[model samples]
Target: MNGDWLLRGRDGRLTVYLPSGEAVLCRAERGPGGPWEDAPRTVGGTQKLHPGAAVGQGADRYAHLAAWRPTVPGESGLVHTTHFRPLLAPLDWVPIGHPDKKGDRTGPPAVAVDGPGRGYVFVRNAGGGVSLRNQKVKGGWGGWLDLGGQEIEERLAPVAAESGRVELYACAPGAILHWHQEGDGKKPVRAAEVEAAVRPGTLRALATSAEHTTVFFTDDSGDVCAWRPGEKPVPLLAAAGPGPVSAVRCVIEGHDCTVLAQRSASGRVAFAAYPTEQESAGAWWTESGPQLPSDALVAVALDEHEELVAASLSPSTGTLLLTRRKDEPGLALEAWREI
Candidate 1:
């Protein structure tokens, strides 16, 4: 996968980038009936799954992006070492197949929890209905579990890997399913139904935080709402600041603090933080939208100590990047620091 994740507080700026380094969907859905912004949420209302369309012949198709370090900051520098053309499945021994035989899968997205291959994957189709595929890396990628529910428009699946298990989540109209990965040797794990806050069938964003995973929903007001990991989700909190929030991220150890990054309809990067405590959800979390050099912020991340680290904001093309501490080289990456 050429794209990398720029994690911010669940209430701050968020974005996904292509291998070429250009970004897309960096903002949230604008006013009602609007197209998705260049921000980080999935495709919707005729929008294509990004990074995927960007991948074609001679293009680097991200086979799958794996690995995230939530506990450490330094580890954040390189979250995923993507597999190029000769795509390498995480485990070589496991048998692989396209969960989306219809080629609707925006590449394959799966959740592996526990060991090498004990998770479920929900692949998409343009006509509607998702193909649920389960597999045990050790055993084999189980068969595709057909989870036929009302289709969700512009839905992107997020997965979790741990405890020799994998979980797949998707949204359709009014219900959610906890579809488990199964195989020939293994029977399908019963799919559990859950509620998605707000309208029954709006596209939601999901990400895993080590052992826990959270789902985010963009409400009618265009404000971002979230659900709890592992358990039934409850409304957490709205990101603070005057601008609307675009995306939410959970920070891990040795990494940046969890962030909520928002971009206004006009194009501005607003950052917020996801609370370590559940009580913090109701209140608007603290937010900061420092006037950045760029017209848009492509990515946002926090360091372990909760200090804001790197952000791919619209750089002042005419401004010269000075030395870090007045002595650092003009070399990229090391040239940025708080003034």
Candidate 2:
């Protein structure tokens, strides 16, 4: 898998993506926190880490794709079974107008869960409106509700999820989408003014348990904004190299959380992360280099503890940098904790 990347689930199932395409069932079981009995779950189909696993409900293994992209998956169309196989009807191409004009976008419609099945997906619509879509999972199909709308923009990644559905943020638009599981009915109601700021910034989504949510973004000048929603957005490492922050990936291996962000300078891509207390990301970015299927894309997933996992990509290039923890520093790769 030599393309942009996304960690789909805690099952450690990696989705190697290509510009306008992707390859599913890329990697296999590794590290920890996954159901030991179901250590090796395959991609495609409604494969759950455990038979008792439910979507954002009960005490069971949490299952989700590391990320989503709207690309055609190598002209195969993301609706193909090799990418994602649902029993639902084949998705008819809506031709949301010119997909190219929209800037940097990722995979198909996907949702990250913090509390329950409060459907949250990325919508690539007309007039370059980069937005978030929410669907309530109550044993029925809930019409996709629009969340955040980017005036004129491109791609995005799965922001964050916790005890309560917080903000779903993305990049190129430098905005955030907000959703809440409302009134005894787990319906993800859309709210206006979800955009956190107007300053250009890097947008990264990390998953975790019912504890925290992480949103990473970068500014036009190259400064990064790490947001936790209700909390103020903080700056991670400064843009030491040339280009803006390319991508950011958050992964949970054992007990620690790690974020891998990519920076493209003089056409060179470098990936790194900012760790946190809890692995609070369901998806992230992967297009750091020119190696991803859809060029720039998003990633997300849940570990066995139902904790969140993720990664991110940059402006283009399409290469991915994964983040797990670094045992040397108590993290997975080289990261320690968010602090």
Candidate 3:
């Protein structure tokens, strides 16, 4: 499973998106530390590349994949599964067009879904700006709308924070490019900048609650930073290398906390946490996580209860090894049960 993306679906399962456009779904047991189960086959009937995961509510609660359209050669497309189903067989795959006029676009399209099942996909076109499309509730797919900007330098994925308002973000060179839409029937506000950038492909975001969405990425100096809306980016602990960054909002020691994890340049995994009620973003990060053998860290996702499910490519097997922590109260990294 040369997975490219990790995301948690509304069904409380962690989904791993592979380079071949297939997906593997894992679900936890009723309690903490038992065996986890995976679907019998590859879900999401996608035969393309750069798979993205988008989970919406109600009827649209299924996992959506936005990837390079293998059928169309150079364009991108959108496909979705039935809500909360075990097998993520495609409900529909729509060719929504690409951002660039030519060549494969950077990475897979990023998707965000609203409470009512409205979906938005973002792609960095060959023109260097971002291209977007919308799927309205009870309506068909809309046309491509170019939100022009050449500063986006990499094939970083996009994350959407949906509350009453919906906000989207992408990693740009030395900044975080953002977009948002508020109110019914109103236009979206686009491209707000947060001056924090890391190596391409390392940015990640988590919508902790309805009121707060935090973005994290390794900076140029190898330090991880956390950014919230209307606040400056807060620098946290340093990493040995710039790999991937992931965060999960969970209860630890009976208090809400965000567990931030990253892979060092040397291929070791590390994690740290801070209280959700803490006001300062510059809080220290404790190095209490378990180090695992990995070539590249793929994706990290949390279930409905905030139990973490992380996948990394095994250096020896070249397959995805899945791990989850025991359900206990401790800041230190718990022993991971391999699936």
lDDT scores of the candidates, listed in order: 0.37, 0.38, 0.57
Q: For this target, which candidate reaches the highest lDDT against the unseen true structure? A: 3
What is the per-residue lDDT of model 2 for residues 1-339, given as tens digits with 9 covering 90 to 100?
111233333334333332222323333333443211222223444321111110111111233332332443322111211223121121222222222333333333333443554434444444445444343445433443344344533444443354445344444344565444444334445442234553432444554445555655555555555555566655555553432343333344543445444434433334454346322333233223233333333343443333444444432443344444333442233321110
Those runs of model 2 whose alpha carbons end farther than 4 Å from true positions after fitting are 1-5, 8-25, 29-110, 113-119, 127-136, 148-152, 164-166, 170-177, 183-201, 207-212, 240-258, 264-327, 330-339
Collision pairs in model 3: 241-265
* lDDT against true structure, model 3: 0.57
- Rank by lDDT, descending? 3, 2, 1
Ranking by TM-score: 3, 2, 1
RMSD of 1: 13.2
| Residue-level lDDT for 253 in candidate 2 | 50
Instruction: For candidate 3, give the lDDT of residue 207.
Output: 73
TM-score between model 2 and native: 0.51
TM-score of each: 0.50, 0.51, 0.78
Off by over 4 Å in 3: 1-14, 21-40, 46-61, 71-83, 100-103, 162-164, 184-187, 277-294, 315-318, 332-334
State the lDDT of candidate 3 residue by residue for 1-339, as single tens digits. Answer: 211255555555554444323443333332333334542344444343344444333223455545455446544444444335423444544566656544554645566555566666666776777777777656887677777777675444444454544565677667887666666423356746777756667666667666767777678887777777677877777754567666667777777788766666555666667876263643444432345565555456665567665666543444555566665557544544355
